[model samples]
Target: MSLIHALQSALGENAVLTQQADRARYEQDWRGLVNNPSLAVILPKTTAQVAEAVKLCAAHGARIVPQGGNTGLVAGAVPILGPDQVILSFSRLRAVRDVDLLSDTITVEAGLTLATVQQEAVKANRFFPVSLAAEGTAEIGGVISTNAGGLQVLSYGNMRAQVLGLEVVLADGTIWHGLSGLRKDNTGYDLKQLFIGSEGTLGLVTAATLRLYPPVATRASALVGIENIEQGLGIFTSIRHAAGNALTLCEFCTQPALSLGAAHTPNGRLPFIAPAYLLLEISALEGARDPREMLETVLMEALEKGRVLDAAIAQSERERLDFLALREAISEGELREGGAVKHDIAVSLSRLPALVRAVEDLVARTYPSLRPNIFGHVGDGNLHVNIRPPAGQTMADIANHKAAITRDVESLAISMQGSFSAEHGIGQLRLLGMAAHKSQTDLALMRAVKQALDPEGRLNPGKTIPES
Candidate 1:
């Protein structure tokens, strides 16, 4: 029988989607840049099914593109340049297998959305704080694979830290049952960490055991306008000093980002028309003192120190949602306005101001007329540097300039001992950047690991690790 026929026979008709329309949906990514569709879209319902499909593909020398919700910023979920590959999507395997409230951990299938996991935690009177705008759709497998760092990274760290264990299927169809909730394990290599941010190139994540936290009893959010990025950093330091671990998130938004939000999104409210902006949030556990009052006192101190020009604190839950709406709306607003060159990078907390100023100055001198939107989780030092050229410039123009801009910005980030791809994983988008930034020895070690895990190069090849 043919490879397609073998896959269909093993997975049944309902699990295999072979039509052009269905296959088309799996071709491109969120950015709509890469377009390499496949001959079939396999929806595996279990870890055995995933391993079986992968084994069959290996036997036939076929390539497999493992995917989750397809909400990736880079084109990592989509195929690179061939139509002969198979797009193995994990959407059908949505299942929460186990939840140990006493242990403060949950084991869920790869297809479960991050939002669903969060809801499950809430139902159990616990919390899962790794949140993003796409949490409603982005799946747990993709998040773990990408090691996504969201708004709460300042307090909770990234997905890597949140995951205690995982169930991964190797390239040769063997299942590695490392899904233990034990916090302390010095048995051997600690295999779970290898696949957490491997981007599915090393192994296919079937399920994961994630750490949980106590649910927040009270929360406070505010949008504070600062004179510049320096003041924003100062406020962050001051608030962290006052509230300690109670501080949940601290995001920075530039004037351009606020302007874009005000112009595009509905009900977009900019509290203060300052050069830079800061969005601060804090949450406290039950029986703890109200975090709102503490946050207010910190902001008041910032104002006294002349670090904050103006501020708007959320009075109700609805008001807090409105304030967050402005920050989340910036990306869509900027996209609607025109084309933009985007970068997800990180620098040291102490060096953010200098990095931002240097990059801004470099862009101004180089592009002359480009207005960049600089904003992200300032508490964690990750910033999304988006460049929007003046009106009438085609997207091609922006694409043409991506290399030069990326070089300058990435160099600056590297100089400060920061990551080139902070939240966004090193998909095909940053393969070249990886080469530029990473050392020869580092790249070789990564390749050796990839080869050791997926010897056939069938599991999401042409991603994460550069070509050997």
Candidate 2:
């Protein structure tokens, strides 16, 4: 039987889509930037089925692209064009296998959305802190592949930190089920970690045992107008020290970003006109001192010291969500404008000001026709400094400068001792950036690991690790 027939036999015909129309949505990325059509998309409902599909593909030396929510920004989940690769989508593997409240772990199939997992935890009066704008659609598999870091990374870490155990299907179809809820397994060489940020080059993550925490009993939120991004950083540092782990979030946004949010978001307008703004949040257990009063006191001091220009605190959950809407609406706001050169970069907390300054200098020197939508999780030193041209400037104009602009932006991050791919992984989008910016030694090590795992590059080929 042919590969299609074989896949159809293993997983029903409905699960294996071969026609162009059936594979259309899978081909194009969520951002509409990349569209790499695969020979077929095989949807597996269980780990055993995934293993069988991999075994079938391995026999024919066919490459397989493992995809989850398909909401990735770096195009890693999308298949490489012209490879005749098969897309192994885990959309059907949406099962919560186990939940151990005492161990503070939840074992779930990789296809479960982050929002679903968070809701499950909420039902149990626990919390899962790995969150992002794409939480509604992004699955655990893709999240694990990218090692995604989101707003709560300052308090709880990224996907890499949240994973307690993982079950992965090897390139040769062997299942490595290490789903132990143990907090510490002094075992040699924690193999599960290899697939955490491997972006599916190493293996296909079928499921994961993730860490959970006590649900926050009290919360407070504020949207503060800042004199500048640097002042936003200052405010973040002070709050971090004063509130410690209670400081849940400190998201920074530039004037242009606020303008975009104000213009596009229907309800919330930028309350004050300033160089920058911060959407800050603090949360604590019920027994602890009131988080609202603590946040208010900190903001009062910040205001007195000129670290903050203006502030609007959220006294209710509705008001808190309204404040958060401004931060969450940034991507949509940028999209409403037009094409953009986007970068997610990170640096030391102390040098965030330097990174911002460098970005400003780069824009002044090269992109006079564009506006910078500077925003990100400032608490963790990650910033998404994207450049968007005005309506008058054509996309062709933006395209012409995109390559140079991206290089300049990556160069700035390199000079500041920061990283170019902060939360986003080196999927197809950042492959060139990886080659251009990553050191020879780092590339060699990554290549070696890839070779060791998938020797023929039969899994997610031409991504993550750049060729030598």
Candidate 3:
């Protein structure tokens, strides 16, 4: 029997998709960037099935692109090698394998959506802090593979910090079961980490043991209007100094971006107009002081010091979700208006203002037809600065300038000792950035690791790492 027949035999025919309609759902990326067809899309329901599929693909000398939820911004989860590769989708492999409350960890199959994982943790009266707008559909495996960071990184850190252990299937179909929930295991090399952010290039992550935290007993959220990025950063500093880890989130948004987000608000109005806005949140275990009170005090001080122009503290849970809705809607709003030349760049907290200023200057000096929609996890120094085209002009109008715009913005981030790709992993999109921005030593070491783990390049070819 051939590979398709073998896959169908190993995993029921329903699990093996060969028709264009069956494979179409997994073909296009979240951004609709690539829609390359594949030879087959394998839906594995268990680790054994995943291993079997990998083994069969290896035997046939066919490449496999591991995907989860198909919700990646960088087109990392989609295939690019024409009709030769097969997609090993973990959608049916979702299962709550184990939940260790004592260890404060949850082991879940690769296909469990991030939101589902969060809900599972909540069912156990625990908290899983890796959150992003895509949490509703983005899977745990994809998040682990991308090492995604979101609003909460200000306090909890990225996906890397939350992963305690991982169960990975090697490129050659060997199952490396390293799902240990122990927080401290000073064993050999911490091999599980090698596959965490490898973008499915090194190995296929079948399941993961993720860290959990005590449920938030008290929480608070606020949206404050500020005069400029400096004022917004100042407010972030004060909140961090005062609340410490209680400050679970601190997001910055430009006025233009806020306008876009506000359009999605229930009232369809800007919360309170200003040059910039800061949407922040605080959470803590039950304590004498309410988190809302703590947030109020910090904002009061900023207001008294002229750092804050106007502010709205979430008075209830509904209001808090409303506040978050605005921040979350910013990206959708931008897309509705017409997508911009987007860049995910990061710098030190102190240099964020300078980076924003430099980008503004670059746009002003050249490409006068574009406006900036800058916003992100400012507390962690990551910003999604998208330069939008002037009203009525779509991305096509600015097509000629997109390359130069991305180059200059990325180069500015590098000049500030920042990264060109911050939270979003180097999927096929940023491979050019990797070749352009990554140092020689960095590329060589990355290639060495890739060679050791995936010698034949049979796993997710033409992604993450550029050709040497």
Candidate 4:
């Protein structure tokens, strides 16, 4: 029979969505960048069902797009390959399979939200360190697929570090049940790494086993106003030196970005306004020194040294979240402020200031009418450099210049030996960038891997690796 009929018959009619309205939510990307309808959207509740759906799709010669929470900044989870592809959504597969407190690992189904995973860790008296603004809705599977980086990446590393093992369904419907919590595994190529950030291009992730940490005891957060990025970098160094591994977050934002956030988010008022700002956090475990005392001392030194213009340290949990609210509200503000030509780029810690300076110079010299909204996890050298229309003008005003602007900005990042796409994976949005920034050798090796893992290019077709 037909693929849709087969899927409906095998996985139940409720699991296979064909009507336009039912598939609408799965079709759109988080940023509203893509909204192409797929031939069908399948919500598989079990790994076996996922494999069954994939096998049927492969038999019918239909391409499959594996999706998680669909909260990715890039359009990685949505279908862009016309109306012939099928979207395999893991939304119904959320299950806390195991929580081994002694082993310090939790095995969960792919559909579990990051926030839910964090809650589970807390319930087990442990901690899951990787956190982003979209944690409330972004699934663990997509987080693993993107190798996502967030605030705590400064200390706990990215999603890649947290993952110990994964359960994935291959393109041909073979389930690789390689879920292991072992910390030491040198038994070959470490196959799970291949699927971690593959963007669902190689295999469809069904579940994962992730590392956990000791629960945080003391916590502190602060927002520092600075004269420029250089001053912020100096402050970051001072705090990192003092707090060491305790420093969990170090975010930078331009004055324009702060203004945008304040305009959009609740409790988004700035404590002190300056040319730029830094939001920092520290979490202490066990017998570690009080984080507030440590951060306060570092901030005092920064103010005294003239590296920071002013600082406001959070006194309570509510106050700390308020401080973070302003930082998290940045993307929302950018969207409301007529959108922007966004770039997720990064450089070395030492080269970050140079990158910022060079970006400012580029915008000022070429697109004088455009305003640059720069902010991100500065501690990790990843910054979102977004170019928006000046004040009153909308994104449409700079529509023609978007291509040239993106080219210039990405070129600068490449010149600095940085990345064109940092934490955000290379979805369809960055396919052109993949071609523009990556070397022939790099592309060839990636293509080779794609060939080996997904020979038919059935998984996430025309994504991640660009066409040569």
Candidate that would win on lDDT: 4
Per-residue CA lDDT of model 2 for 1-468, tens digit only, reads: 788888899989999999999998887777778887788999999999999999999876689999989888788888787667999999999999998988888999999999999999998899999888889999999999999998889898899999989999999999998887888889699888899999999999999999999999989999999887778877887788879999988899888787777777677777678878899999898798888888788899988887789898997998888777778778877766675778999888888888898888878877776787799988888999898886677456678788888899988888888999899888888988899988899899988988898898899988988777
Model 2 CA deviation exceeding 4 Å by range: none
The clash number for model 3 is 0
Candidate 3 matches the true fold with a TM-score of: 0.98
lDDT, model 1: 0.88
Residue-by-residue lDDT tens digits, candidate 4, 105-138: 9999999999999999999999999999889999
Clashing pairs in 4: none
Best by TM-score: 4
Q: Summarize candidate 3's per-residue lDDT along 1-468 as a digit string, tens digits.
A: 799999999999999899998889898987666789888999989999999999999888889999998878788989995537999998887899999989899999999999999999999999999888888988899999999998898889999999988999998889999898888999789998899889999999999999999999978999899988899888888888888888999999988887888896676566678888999998988663688878889889878887789999888898888888888888878777888888999999999989989988898989777898899988889999899999998888888998889899999999999999999988888998999999999999999999999999999988999988
Question: Per-residue error at 6 for model 1, in Å?
Answer: 0.8
Comparison by lDDT, 2 against 4, better one: 4
Give all candidate RMSDs, comma-separated: 1.3, 1.2, 1.3, 1.0
Over 296-383, each residue of candidate 1 has an lDDT whose tens digit, in order, gives 8988877887878998899999888877778877877766766578788998888999889988998889987777789999998999
Which stretch of 10 consecutive residues in model 4 shows the poorest summed lDDT? Answer: 75-84
Query: With candidate 3 superimposed using the best TM-score fit, by how many Å does residue 67's alpha carbon deviate from the native?
Result: 0.9
Candidate 3 ranges with C-alpha deviation above 4 Å: 265-268
Q: What is the lDDT, from 0 to 100, of the residue 316 in candidate 1?
A: 95
Order candidates by lDDT, high to low. 4, 3, 1, 2
Q: Which has the better lDDT: candidate 1, or candidate 3?
A: 3
